[model samples]
Target: MNTKQSRIRRSRKTRAKIAAVKAIRLSINRTNSHIYAQIISADGGTVMTSVSSNDKEMRAQLPNGGNVGAATVVGKRLAEKAKGLGIEKVAFEAAREGGLVF
Candidate 1:
């Protein structure tokens, strides 16, 4: 298969592993111009908390949220929100063609 298809294959395996663990998940998504993160329940049915560069508060602090710095900011913000929502730890999930990160 080609590179894109190979990546998707890898990601599907990763997601299947995550699903098997049946733990809360910290899902992250990064695009060319923004980063987003969310804390989902063990069954992945509930969103406990979420944060993104698109948020008004984060947007005001960042001129643009496309780089690693923006990812870090979104990660920290999401962590805080999750903590406030009583979430202390989680597994990580990613898209079918992506990888997980802290």
Candidate 2:
């Protein structure tokens, strides 16, 4: 499989495991030009909160929005938004399935 397909396969497996627990999920999608994150309900119909470099606030801080710094900034913003949405905890998915801890 190609790189993108392989990544999707990995992501599906991770999402399946997360779905098993049925907890609120904070999934991240990092693209070459931007980073996006969302807090999804356990059933996946609703998105409690979301943020990205494309957002107005983030757009100012991360004008380029395509670097590790931008990704980290998006992560922090999403977490803060989730907290405001009364989501104190979440299962974070890297979208890349990195070796880094959750």
For each predicted model, how many residue pairs clash, with residues at least 3 apart or on different chains? 0, 0
Q: Cα lDDT of all candidates, in order?
A: 0.76, 0.77
- How well does candidate 2 score on lDDT at residue 53? 92
Question: Over the stretch 1-102, how does candidate 1's per-residue lDDT look in tens digits?
Answer: 899999889888977787898878777788999998887888878887888999999999998898988887787777667667767667754332122332
Q: In model 2, where do residues sit more than 4 Å from their true spots? A: 93-102
Which pairs of residues collide in model 2? none
Distance (Å) between predicted and true CA of 44, model 1?
A: 1.5
The sequence of per-residue lDDT tens digits that candidate 2 reaches over residues 1-102 is: 999999889989988998999988877777899988887899988988888899888898886897988887777776666666767767764343222234
What's the TM for model 2?
Answer: 0.80
lDDT of 2 at 28: 72
TM-score of each: 0.84, 0.80
